[model samples]
Target: MAGDSVRDDELAWLDATEQAELVRGGELTPSELAEAAIERIERTNGALNAVVTPLFEKAVAQAASAQLPAGPFRGVPMLLKDMVCHSAGDPLHGGMRVLRDHGWTEPEDSHLAARFRAAGFVFCGKTNMPELATSVTTEPLAHGATRNPWDPSRSPGGSSGGSAAAVAAGMTPVAHGNDMAGSIRVPASCCGLVGLKPTRARTSLGPGHGEYWGPVAHEHVLTRSVRDSAAVLDTIRGMAPGDPYTAPPPSRPYREEIGLDPGALRVGLRTAVPGAAGQPHQDCVAAVDEAARLLESLGHHVEPSAAAVLDSPAILEGFSAVFGTIVAWEVDRWSQRIGRRIDLGELEPMNARTAEVGRSAPATQWLSGLHTWQQWAREAAALWEQELDVLVTPTLATPPWQLGELAPTALAPAELAAAVGEKIAFTVPFNITGQPAISLPLHRNPDGLPIGVQFVAAYGREDVLIRLAAQLEQAAPWSMARPPVSA
Candidate 1:
């Protein structure tokens, strides 16, 4: 087979779908593709700090080996976020300084990792993230902050910031990223990519734990194309044997939904997060306005909305008990596995105190908070069934903030909840509701920072999102909007 002579600069611009097709068509060998990615990572990672643990040798060996699986993404390179994603026998620091200090490695592959391998993905490296994934900005003390490819001085939304950066900069076309609250979509917004927080139980987070934050957290990917997101989701979405919950199965593979007509759908436009946290920045508000116009242009009905569930202080109170306690649990579990006690001093101040507050909170309060979030989820989901088919809002209240500005370490757990919750205001409510939400990079501020517009669908309805996202993506393409500090 004759391979196409893909130049390094030209190769950097292709999305995963294009890259995989080129490989399949004998225009790019898997080995050549892998080497190009490694070289790109080496060239760009120093400035981006996106890939913390380079698996260059491993990726090269796997790429050249004949023992590769015949999966859809075969020959395409990817990165895993430094969190629940694990590759057996590889360093797996989840952006935690304590684990990094100990040189911890995962003993086995997470189910997701196994599926990724099965899909013909070459594991390139692990990306940087915030400490304990507690912050939206990826300024991890362990690996340092992952700078936005859009603007190095600004933050890439975290804790998947590293993955987003790498993907944005063309170091990798797609990367693994999980959402506890807004980890996936926030960074997608900041980095100008497609980030989908799948429905609760849509994908497995197995062997480690069944649920997180009373089931708000989810695992997914960050990619430049809607079709890439859909294809990856098709490859990875399923119920593992021991999963506690199972999202209703899609009628067919989600990839098929990419170009499908979404019909005349009712869309709710929420420009600002309601309540004391205040309006989204003017850029963010304008993004919503712009997205509404775009959706209407596409023949969808758009109407004004106020996210009532997020407006209440109850969200912070209810979120605190579950978030704090689960964090404490994960830390203790990891400590036991490593056979070492976590010195409070070793953890970032906010995370250390977060665990402390979690430990002190009553078990009853944790249970109560779980119930509250579920209720909030129901109320939020009701909008779709009653008045709208999708809800659109600014992914973050504002565009990317400068590094170190949002990680307020001095605050108490409740105070931190108010602060952190406000930053992820639009995305978290859907996490609470177990609905599928997506952040589309549809608009850019005057400063050229991307302002992602979020569209949330009812529980287990990512097909609707994929169809709508594909339409929106075609309306306003962002693939050519590469950051200045790119591969």
Candidate 2:
């Protein structure tokens, strides 16, 4: 599996699209690509801690397999996010010390994993994340935090932080990640890459499941190129029989959508999300304004508008309840598997808090939260119809935070709420509404860290977001910008 090392000149930290092209054209074999990625991962991951659980041997075996997809990205190397999804023979710790023991995965593959293999990706193993993929920073108890490539002292944003960091540092062209609450987009913003949270159900999650909690998680990839994101989505988007619901399919392939000219769109601009409290940092605001100007220059109509508040104070309180419910369910499931009554003492502080919240919630309160979420979704959908092709906002209210700053144990519940509120002020609303949103790296801070401009489209309108991303990428190219840690 050895040959001439990837030439430095040929290593511009290419995205999945470029890697796929080279591999498909016979310029690079999967083994060579995997080797290059593994080399970079070994060289840098010690400092970054991005690839928390490496499956190098399995990846090598997979890469050496003769059978591979004939698609454009056949024979590419990719990494999986650490939480939720399971890969056969991979020790998935789920980013929690309590659950570090390997769990059983079916002999057969999950649909998503099957699709990845079919796309010719050599699975390079899992990346780090917050416990249960619950938080925005990858500081789980089992594996230490994944450091930001741009600034080692800062977080790369998580639960998909490792995926973002790996791609940003060129350990891989692109990596599979999930967004349950700005997970993908937050890391994309911090790491200066393209991350799209496709419409709910756009990508199937299982052969044995439906929607995850109905509001939050969505499957997608984080990449350097919009085309790469689209290509991955194209391969995975479809509904399995058990899916609760499938998002409307695009008329064309997602990859093709990326190149299609998005005609002048009526973009609604809102720096502040009403009732969604937080003061966006100057850098974050600047990123949004610059994106607006860029859009105007690209012939799109940018109109100022305040985001409509779909949920009031009463409904806003329901979010934590819903989250807690998820925590309790996972804890119970794990407890049963481990043959012990799981005590909150062994869990991370945040996990403990979530479990407490869940335990304290009355059945009536859980139902109320679900009702509020559904009502808000309806209201938000209606508002989108009245105005705006898409909503633009700061992907994050603040720039990247110092490493360990947002550790769940360090902050009190109020402080944690306030901090989370500030960091992802604009993103959670879309997650609640199940709308498609993307983070485009359009601005750089003085220190050269990437700042992302987020554009959110109406529910199930991923095509529109892809088209918009392509337009923005063309207008203000972030491809030329590379982090100092880039290979």
Candidate of highest lDDT = 1
Candidate 1 per-residue lDDT over residues 1-487, each given as its tens digit: 1245878888888888899898888888998889999999999999989999999999999998898777998989999998887999899888887889889999998889989999999999999998888888888779888899999989998889999999999898999999988999999999989999999988888877677556887988999999999999998899998888789999999999988999999888877675555678999989989988889999998888765655866677677668779878878888898998777667777788778888888999899998887777677666778888898888988889887676546456467656776788777777777899999999999999999999998889999999999998889888888788999
Q: 55, model 2: CA deviation in Å? A: 0.7
TM-scores for the candidates = 0.97, 0.95
The best candidate by TM-score is 1
lDDT of each: 0.86, 0.80
Backbone clash count for every predicted candidate, in the order shown: 1, 0
| Model 2 regions more than 4 Å off | 1-9, 101-108, 273-278
RMSD of 2: 2.0
Which residue pairs in model 2 clash with each other? none
lDDT of 2: 0.80
TM-score of 2: 0.95
Candidate 1 local Cα displacement, residue 211, angstroms: 1.7
